[model samples]
Target: MAKIWVFAEVNNGKVDTAALEILTKARELGGEVEAVALGPGSTDAAKELGQYGATTVYASDDEVYADYVAQPAAHALHELVKEHAPELILFATNYDSRDIAGRLSARTGSTLMSNCFDILGTDKARTTIFGGATVVDVALEGTPKIALVRPKSFEPEASGGEANVMPVEVDIPDDLKKAKRVERHEEQASGPKLEEAPIVISGGRGLQDASNFELLDQLAGAIGNAAVGATRAVVDAGWVPYAYQIGQTGTTVKPGVYIAFGISGATQHIVGMKGAKTIIAVNKDEDAPIFQIADLGIVGDALKILPQLIEEIKTRKG
Candidate 1:
């Protein structure tokens, strides 16, 4: 039986959804699925990985990795791969995973396929091309191949099992920690994060300016469990942070409900949100390209409609 190794990323003592998603699919591949958890919450993340079908969890939360040494993390992963010799190694598309996967690919001499949504057979994976207009199949040759799976690409599940946690420690070369973290600045984020939110209200250039995004914020507050998102134009114009961007160059969202206000639905923008279950577009132009894919197209000014809509929703709930 071919063994599969999944590197699980931990955030605030929880296993990242992307890591759980890949682990669920890894079980479907009919093999021994082992997970590697890193960082401060490695212990908690290992248990969560086990619940998602990871049989053996190699945990490394030693000071070198806990301190966030990217190079040492990559080195430790290389050493594990050299010892275990798993056929397939999976990673999430997050920053740290991409960094480690790239370096490990170079170290192992195995090609790394990034931005994959699905894994086919054991070695082949499926990815999108041409701004998500085309489907491409990629098959890797040789052992210990790496695949970086996109976030929210698969469903996360729990199998109600416990993992055999194995502690892994590696020596960190002195030169690798040359870069030290000076300070970490975080924006004040409210409500559910955009990527994981089931309902998203996104605005584009049509909102006019940064202050206009308040309309979306108010609506999101009223709608309950909704996250506000922004188009590339608005993000580039500094109306919102890049974290709120949903477009070809930004996050790929497949929310249950997607409401677009003032968005023209350019091909670039559509690539990111086309997978949504229901799309509602509000634009002044009846001929807006956004209407082409929208399940409900409203031809009107959003500014005027939103206030009334918010009031009506509040009244109905009351």
Candidate 2:
């Protein structure tokens, strides 16, 4: 049997959904699945990690990981790699994970395959290239191959067991702690997060103005559990925050129901949401490329149709 390790990131006192997803996939690859968790709540999150198929968890509640950036964790992970010698290491495709993976790659001289959506046996992973139009298999060569997996690539499952937790020990020199975290600010959001939401309502340049996003807000409000998202074009135009942007350069969402408003469906944008279970696209242009993939297509002005749709939803709910 092979040995695999997953970097399980924790958020809001729980294991990150993406990490759990990766853990589940790692378990399916017929390996001895282990996890490395850091930060304040990592030890507490180990039980959940075990429930998601991790047989063992190397947990570190050291403040250095939370107080500073990626260097300290990278150094610690490098030491762990030398000691344990896992055949493969999996990481979630997120901000901190990417930072740590890059630094660790430099330290270990390993082949890092990023944006992978599937693991093919023990030596290959599948990813999309050229704006997600072409699918290719990447070889995982060299010792302790590292792979960064995309969000929503696999469904998470619980093994109904607890993992044996062990403490991670490493010494960090002062030079590695140059960059320190002074403060942190998070956006105040309601309902579900955009990536985790079952229903996603998105807008694009066809909305005409920033104020038109209010229509999406109203629709989300009416839907009760839906989250709002925007295209890169609208986000660049200052219509919404970068967090709401969904594209090749932004967040990737695979909601159960994805409703697109006025998006022309560029390949960059489609790469992010094409995995959605059902896609509904509304655009005035009948020949829009989005219509090619949309399960339901509406040929009309999105701005004009939004008000009527909101009222109808409100009336139906009432």
Candidate 3:
């Protein structure tokens, strides 16, 4: 039987949703789920992981774990894996997770599968694919296999009862100790997370001016619970923050409804949002590439169409 290890991420004492998603899948694999949380105040963090099906939660509470740097956290997880000898390791496919996954793979000589959307199993091994396309099946050649799972790929399953939290003590590796976090900075924004939002309203070059984004905000607000997204061009033009950008080089979103206002639908952008359940495009150019994949398309200026759409939604709501 292979025991599964999941990295439970915490920042400012708040647990990330990605950790819950990984534990949910770990349970489905029929393996013993163990979660590792490394931070200054991680006791409460570890307990939260238990509510989501983690059988054993390892909490590392040390000053070295105070920062969210990837190296120290990876070292802590590496130590836990050495002691427990888990058959598989799981991580969320975020920027920090990618760094930690790479470091851990190099340390343990484990096979790495990154950005896996689905895990298929035959009696022999597990398989996953990348880019929401191309299926590659892999059987581990080593004792433990590691996989970085994409967020929003799987729905989290809540544990019916309380979870068991265990505190594990391990000496921090010297190599990781050498690297310390001197400063921490965060970009504060108020809104729903783009990946978690039910509806996403995005704009492209067709909008022409950065100030025109207020139209998108208006439409998004009308939709209620909609998030604003932008194309690479718009982001490069400084129309929106990089976090709101969606494309091959940006965040991949799978919202229930994706509304593209004035976007031309480059393949790079299309691939990122192709997983959306419904796509609607508003552009004057009927030949815009976005129309090919859009479920509904309007041939008009987005600036004009957006306000009308917002009014219609408001009227319907009332």
lDDT of 2: 0.91
Q: How many clashing pairs per prediction, in order?
A: 0, 0, 0
TM-score of structure candidate 2: 0.96
Residue-level lDDT of model 2, residues 93-113, one tens digit each, is 888999999999998999999
| lDDT per residue (tens digit) for residues 60-146 in model 3 | 677677654667777877877888898888888777778888999998998888667666531233333343345565655675678
**lDDT (10s digit) by residue, model 1, range 1-318:** 999989998866778888899999999999899999877779767888899999999897665665654788888888889888999999988877888889889999998998898999679999888767799999899988999888777888888879999888777788877655555565647899888789999999988878988989999999899999988999999989988988766787889999999999887888889989999999999999999999999999988888888899899989
Q: Give the TM-score of each candidate.
A: 0.93, 0.96, 0.87
Instruction: Choose the strongest candidate by lDDT.
Output: 2
Ranking by TM-score: 2, 1, 3
Pick by TM-score: 1 or 3, better one: 1
User: Which runs of model 3 end up more than 4 angstroms from their true locations?
Assistant: 66-68, 122-133, 173-183, 247-250, 285-287, 315-318
Model 3 Cα shift for residue 251 (angstroms) = 3.8
Give candidate 1 regions above 4 Å deviation.
none
